[model samples]
Target: MREAQFYNKIEDLIFCNLCPHGCKLSEGQNGTCRVRKVIDGKLYSLNYGKISAINLDPIEKKPLYHYKPGSLILSVGSVGCNFSCGFCQNFTISQTGETFFTTFISPEELISIALKYKEKGNIGIAFTYNEPSIFYEYIYDTITLLKDELDIILVSNGYVNQSPLKDIIKHVKAINFDLKAYNEDFYEKICHGSLEPVLKSIEIAYNYTHVEITTLIIPGLNDSEEEIDKLSLWISKLSPNIPLHLTRYFPNYKFQIEATPIETLVKLQRIAKKHLNFVYLGNVLLPSNTVCPNCNKTLIKRNGFEVQSFMTSNQCPFCSFEIEYIKI
Candidate 1:
């Protein structure tokens, strides 16, 4: 158990300012995240160093198409999440605590493991699977230790507070933020969170490092054309080059809503492409290729997670159009 970073004491309760939740807990009480707790009138992170899952996955599996396209990354996830989404796919780990089976991997040991896979095209570490913002201290320590030796990526819900987000973004190279939905009601009722903080986080993150956004299109909830247009336009205002992923949603956890229609994903992708330069469909396989937004020339050909062919440089070989990609 490690002392948490973003919290302070009130009269008798400790207030956790990690995310927008601002959970106030008395002694021996856990926050809504199920990880952060109040012990002796101070906040503690119960999930620190307790890894629920780890794997070496293709960076594309993170759905990060624009950043480090073909490289593999050591993905690590800890328990607990700030949002209580009903359709959470990783709820087994994200909603559990230390009582659940987990391995204790120190920062030094994790770094050694990453270095061991350097020859296997492992670019660096990705704090993913669960909401990484809840495990801020562990991530901060590990990234500080690794520094520039390995690139750091975050797969997060992006519901973090400004101060902590700013502090951690410096060490991160790229991030895949789950935008979830554009409507405030959807955020409040479906995810038990708000939309404003997530939008704010995206705006703040892109300034420091590469940013990609993902929105899972659930059938009845956030799959409307208007919402997709608003979300795409908002992202375009930041930068049209930002890659947007429209993923299919399946029944999971508490939500038993039928899987999202492929037709909805295709329609939303077309609508998104109107404002965004790079748009891709996920989950159900369509064409997962990157094309030059200007000339509509296939720039990167991908077969599943494998990169079949791509331009040697950042510019399109045929049209010389600048491709928005981080060089691997």
Candidate 2:
């Protein structure tokens, strides 16, 4: 177990500042995330180096279309999450505690495993599947050990506090940030979190690395046209080049609402495209091809996770438009 970063001890209790929860815990008490705990008056990350899931997945599976298209990444994930979203897809692991089964893989061991897959086009490690920020110490240590030898990708909810967020952004090359909604009411009632910090995270992350935003379009929750408009506009204001993914949500975990309509995703895609240069529809058997924003020329054609065709490099051949993608 690693002593966690971004925490302080007050008397006999420890306050975790890793995320917005700011959970204060006495000895043997776990935080809202169910991973960090106060053990003997010190905060410890219970999930540190304890990997619950590991796989070599297509970069697109991270739903990251813009960064490193047509490449495979070594994806890794632990348990526990800061936010308690009602419709969590990975709830089985995210909501669980240290009792959940996990394999212990040190940072050096993980890097060695990644090196074995170099011929298979493994770019680097992706800290995903659960709220990675909760395992801040492990990730920070792993990235420090890597020293940019491999790419570091983060798929996160973006609910972390700025101080910790700023430190992690320096090591990551790209991120797929989940912007659940456009307003605070949806965040507080449905996600058990706030929206302002997420927006702040996106704004801060894009300045340091390539950032993409994903919003799971839940039915009757955050799928309204007005909400989509506000979200797209806010992202565009940051930079129209920021890729926005409008994913269809299925009933899962506590929220058993009906699956989001394909029509809703289609409509939201159009709404997002009006303001954003790169808008893609996910979780449906639809075209998620990336096109040149200027000339409408196809840059990358994807069929599910398979890349059927794509530009040889980051530049569009038809119009020579410089696409904002990591070409390796």
Candidate 3:
């Protein structure tokens, strides 16, 4: 087990400041994340190098529509998350503890696996599936070692504190930050967290890597037209060019609300488009295609996960408008 970072010893206990939770733990007890424990007066990361799942997946599966469009990326994730969102899609892994997990793979082994797939059009590694921030030890070490050859990516809730985030951003090439809502009350009530840190993380990431934002518009929770406008407006202030994906939230985990209505998804997309350049619907399909903001010409056409057609030389074939991204 690796020693966790951003912690302070408090007599026989320690306060872990990895994320906003600031979990205070007694000796032999764990933090809110359940992955950081205080043992012998120091905090340690229990899930380091203990990945629950690993696979080669499409970059689009990361829901990253703009960065390296159709390339494959080695997706990896360890258990444990800082938030207790009611709509967590991967709760079995994110909320489960060390007792239920058995996989033990080192950073070197993961890098080797990614390198093997590199020849087959894989861009690099994506820390995904669950919250990757809680497994900071393994991620930091692996990225440090593979920085020369790999482009590391983070799929996160954007709840991490600044110190650790600043330390790792140099290694990350891109990130997809989940922005659950634009209101603080929604975060506190449903997500068991605050909204400020997530916003700060997005701003920090925008300066460091290719940052894309996703807001799962849960029906009756955060899908109001006003909320969508607020969320998109905040992102637009950061950069209107940043792609904002309005994903359809399905009923999952503890949230038994009805599936997000397709009409709601389309309406949110329309509302978001008012502030952002590239807005798309995920989970359910809309006209899943990329169009030029300047000319209204189709640039790339996608049906579900399939890329059906590409026009121009990565530009709008009709208007010669340079495409913002390259099809990989």
Give TM per candidate.
0.98, 0.97, 0.95
Error of 1 at 321 (Å): 1.1
User: Taking the candidates one at a time, how many backbone clashes does each contain?
Assistant: 0, 0, 0
RMSD of 3: 1.7
lDDT of 2 by residue, 1-328 (tens): 8988899987887988988889989889999999988877788889989999999999999989878788999999999998888899999889887644999999999999998999999999999999899888888998889999999999999989999999889889999999999989999998898999999999999889999889999988899999999999999998988989999899899988999999989988989889998899889999989888879988788988888555777777898888665453
Candidate 3 wrong stretches, greater than 4 Å: 308-317, 322-328
Ranking by TM-score, best first? 1, 2, 3
Would you list the C-alpha lDDT of every candidate in the order shown?
0.91, 0.89, 0.85
Model 1 over residues 1-328: C-alpha lDDT tens digits?
A: 8999989897997988889999878999999899988887788899999998999999999979888778899999989899889899999988776635989899989999999999999999999999999989999999889978999999999999999999999889999999999999999998999999999999999999999999999998999999999999999999999999999999999999999989989999999999999899999878889888778888778889988556877888889887665464
Instruction: Give me candidate 2's TM-score against the actual structure.
Output: 0.97
Sorting all predicted structures by lDDT, with the top scorer first, yields 1, 2, 3
Instruction: Name the runs in model 2 displaced over 4 angstroms.
Output: 325-328
Please tell me which model should have the higher TM-score, number 2 or number 3.
2
lDDT of 1 at 225: 95
Worst 10 residues of 2 by lDDT: 319-328
TM-score of model number 1:
0.98
Q: List the residue pairs that clash in candidate 1.
A: none
